[model samples]
Target chain A: MKHFSLRKLFLGCGALALFILAWKLVTDAKLVSPIFFPGPERTYAALVKGLSGGAMLSQTLETVQRMLLGWLLASFVGVFLGVLIGVSRRARAFIAPTLELLRPLPASAMIPIAIAFLGFSDNMVLVVIAFGALWPMLLATIHGFAAMEPRLYEVSALLGLSRAQVIWKLALPSAMPMILASLRLGLTISLILAVVGEMLASRQGLGQSILAASRSFRSPDLFAGIVILGAIGLVGSRLLSFAERRLLRWQAVSR
Target chain B: MVVTQLSTRPRHGEGNSTPASGEARIRIFDVTLSYGSLQIIGGISLDIAPGETICVIGPSGCGKTTLLRMLAGLARPTSGSVELDGSVLGGPNRSVAIVFQDYGKALLPWRTAAGNVSLALEARGCPGAERLAITREMLEKIGLGRHADKYPAEMSGGMQQRLQIARCLAQEPKVLLMDEPFGALDAMTRQALQDEVLGLVATTGATMVFVTHDLEEAIYLGDRIICLQPNPGRVGRIVDVRLARPRNQLLTRENPEFLRLRRELYDLIKDDHQ
Candidate 1:
């Protein structure tokens, strides 16, 4: 296992080196305009300057905070409604059609409507992010609960578990793997929506900084922001996986 | 092998107020189960005595599982009632537990052997302090003491089934309903589990209603065997297994009475199919 991970690490570093070398080559050969596409050194310099001056740091912190807040709210609402519909036939019949109808509408489409109602406030951006991230969590949770084996319910009933106990102990725990997977998907959506929301409606996040740098012809700052966004997504997903592994150790052992 | 004479005592509650020697622990009174218009179980009546291991044997569609479900209070009879301890059972209560056939599905994959057993104890409202001790004791009883920390997925089929049995036993049920508990096991594992179950029932004195399609298995573990006819299942025959207690696998199979019972049950099932 250690050797395999070491091999993977080597390959990952090799790929990154190749990408940076290609970027440097393109810049040296003047394949693209420097104004539009800066060199890796310039982008790295911008990143270091932003971090030292605390400008990019504050913007990144804002984006991270908004993303986490919106994602948490979405998770709570989505899981609540998902479990409700998943468990009850009447709830599913009544609510599923409406949810299905609304689910397909892109979160970006809601941006104009959100701006119209809430204007250029953090609340407007949060609304967009939360709305964007809710569907994956909701749908995955519903699928998880619905696909559970009937025998588990029978066992619960025979054991004389109360309805609440059955839902809490059996249904929720059984649906956890799917729920966690959906949460990971929601995290990606949350990040994307947070950036998009900031670019469109707010003035205080990495997305805004990237947009401002582009408008002012600061190519290195724009690329640095984009790179930072990518780094955030990568790190966030890795952290979630680490938590999933820890919490679901039984699943790992069982497999 | 010692030959124990079959008891011909009359069933309890015939005319006396005192609980008789063969007092019925569970009574199915003209129970019929249907799904919409499709009848799954036709009118069937049965009386199971305390500490008796009654096996229900039949063809595939013979509602053996349906009968067991009704007894477990997981399903209700369409026409009649199931009585436990002289009272009509309305729904699943603390007095009964079930061992399902598909151990893979029945036992929680997320829980260890001890944790799965603790699920039953938790449901029964056993205090937190006592749960660990009881869980360990139950697991040890099922010969899974060394593997208490293992999840169901890590265990072999036999081990998983034993874990499931241990979980049910942790419920401290007065009546245990098993629906083909060992049906998926290999021949050797099935035989071992069968003997283990017989020993458990003998020690616990719990009334058991085991459903299976294997005739020899029914005769080997059962005190009385109920054969059901299919296509709207109903009891076709009730055989009293007069074999002695603590039965040996080889000697019991070789016994003339065991062979006769097996043949009789096989003929009954064959006639039903015809």
Candidate 2:
């Protein structure tokens, strides 16, 4: 297993090196105009310049802040409502149809409506990001709650657990694996919507910076911005997975 | 030893020889359970004395589990009443704890063996400072002292079952209901757990209602074996197991009385299935 993972690591690095080499070859051979497609060297130079200037740092932070805020709010509401609807038949019957209908509509599509209602503001962008992230978290939570075995309920009930105790001790923990999975998915969606919202309707974020760079034909800066966005996604995913590993250590051990 | 013939009608307060041995710890009075138009448990009545270990044996769909659930107040009887110490069992009573057959599902997978046992103490509002000590004690009692840190999934089937039993015991219950808890274990593990349970109950003196389809197991563990017939399950027979206490797995199985009781239970079940 150790040797296999080492081989996998070598392969991954080789794949990345090959991709950069291909990009360098294309740019050096002028397969595409440097005006449209910047080489890896030029992109890296632009990225360094942006970092030193602090403009890219602020923009990246802005986008990340929006994503985190929206994602957190969505999680809070989604889990709360999901559990409520999951456990109560009446609540599900009353609320599920509306959520189901709303779930399929893309979060980006709501940008126009959000702009109309809230104008071009941070709140507008945040609302859109939250809206986009909500469905996955809500649906996952509901599924988690619904999938709970009846026997757990029986065990808790026989133990004379109060309603609050049952939910806290059994329901929440039992649904955690599913809940965490949804949060991972939601985090990605939140980031996507955060950038999309900035590109469409906001002024101060990585999305706006990227859009601005592209409009001015700064291909290197555009490439640099894209790379930064990818890095942000990578970091966010890694952080969440770290948290998942810590929180679900028992799940891993059991497996 | 007295054996009661299967009675289709409710025969509340009729089987126990010692009527004055206080009130029945758990009294099922003409209880019937149904879902919609389909009856699952037909009129069934029985009484379990305090500290008695009653094993329920029957074929599939016999409502043995349902009866156990009713006794635990997890399910309400469709008609008639189930009483715990003379009060109608309205809902789950704190004094009752259940050991379900599917230990994998019954135990909280997210908790360690000790954490799972702690759940009961926590629910019962055992003081925070005392939970760890009690958890360790219970885990030790179930022979899982070394495995207290292991998750239910990390443990083998028998270990998980022991963890479940430990959790149940931590409830400090007056009544322990086991629903085919050893059904998934191997023969050796099953016998070991049987003896462990017998020993635990001997010390605890808790009223036990164990449900199983295994005739020999029922005979070995029970003070009285209640056999139920299926198709809206009802009491079919109540056999008194006169086998000696502190039963030896090898010696008890070899005892003539144990063999006779096993034979009798097997014939009774065979006739019911046919």
Candidate 3:
């Protein structure tokens, strides 16, 4: 519940200003060729131009939409399977090793498989993104339920809770903090895979925009695309953290 | 011969239907618990009368909590049996409730005070419309009425324990098992809660099997105190509390009989540690 203090805010802003000054100096001195590395003003100008009712706006929205959808899909599949695997020792024993094997497979490795089935479509990109984002959530949820306090089992028994009641009323709430942390992790991966999938599949999104800009040596637009992506990441994480604060207030107000 | 003699009363199903008196009686028959050759409780037998409060005092590793868990049906005796109402207790019973020593882990952290209390009611399949009223009444009984909306993390240790007790009370349990519930609280809170618990027991007439490490808690709370020895835990001694009813915190402990019992029990437990 600690708010950002005025002094900390001032310090943060000051550091940003200093960084911008240093970037300007480097560009002016031509430390790197201006053709490859655009100056801040040029990047900013390109950003404004692209956002003000340009194709970049639609492209950015497409990327955000894809990221959110893929993340949601992975979340559903991950939690459903996670809970199934978590509550039963036999389920975990039988299926966990197979999941572990699939976990380490890279998203890039799955693109060809998705293309073979989906053929460079929106579905292909979503499949890639979901596959990449599923592990953190699944692993964290399984670990969360497994690491639960043993006392709760006794408490549940004494309360005469059924298996379903134990999972719903006892297990889910107990595993929430870990689940939330994993969800945040999953969200970041989802965004990364969304951008990668777009570039590889040639879908219309910020990823394709950046790829085209770099190939065409439109350095300003490329820089602008990178900046937009970073902004999206910041906003997505902020929204998630806000949700976390609201849901976890019980753990907070006590402190 | 070392058994604590069962206090006789009309048992359940004898047309005994009132909440003021006996509704259930617990009988432990040669209950022995062993974990893969590590003997915990060896051949322990006792009879708990309907509505009688029995406090078990023992040293560490004496299987006091183990014994209580058996009564709660959380753990099954390996070689022996626990019975209720003239039937062999199989699994957890709806009419049994337990208050653990570690109340922090016992309560749901995410739930409000009243919500936590409602968990027991929910398990009982109580009607949704009736849940709120019963939850409120249970809170009021344990003096947590004002803090109904607060979470367990927001409350003091004593209040959390009280909330746990309230949840158990909501079960309307015929048998309430406690495992040193106030062992972690401050002395003042512990004494206050003890009196409150006693008052609740007096009103509800529930059978209680309380496990504690403190001799005075056993003396102050029990109609009969069962002393247990460690290293293959078995009943060491059983003393009947002849002290007067409606026991006061100060007056009850000051009684010469209380001190004598405390001295005797202390030596009984102290020997096990050697």
Q: Pick the candidate with the highest DockQ.
A: 2
TM-score of each: 0.93, 0.93, 0.93
Worst 10 residues of 2 chain B by lDDT: B1-10
Q: What is the lDDT of candidate 3?
A: 0.87
**Which lDDT values do the candidates have, in the order given?**
0.87, 0.88, 0.87
Error of 3 at B243 (Å): 1.8
Q: What's the true lDDT of residue B23 in model 2? A: 79
lDDT of 2 by residue, A1-255 (tens): 799979998998899999999999999999999999999999999999998895998898998999999999889988988888877768878988899899999998999999999999999998998888988878887878778888888888877777888878888888898889889899999989989999998559999999999999999989999999898888889898899889999877744
The positional error of residue B95 in candidate 2, measured at the CA in angstroms, is 1.3
Q: How far is B236's C-alpha from truth in model 3 (Å)?
A: 2.1
| Candidate 2, position A61, lDDT | 90
Model 1, range B175-246, lDDT digits (tens) per residue? 988899898999999999999988898899998999988899999999888887766777777788899989
Q: In candidate 3, which residue ranges exceed 4 Å CA deviation?
A: A1-3, B1-24, B271-274
In Å, candidate 1's interface RMSD is: 1.8
Q: Report the C-alpha displacement of residue B100, candidate 2, in angstroms.
A: 0.7
**Model 2 interface CAPRI class:** medium
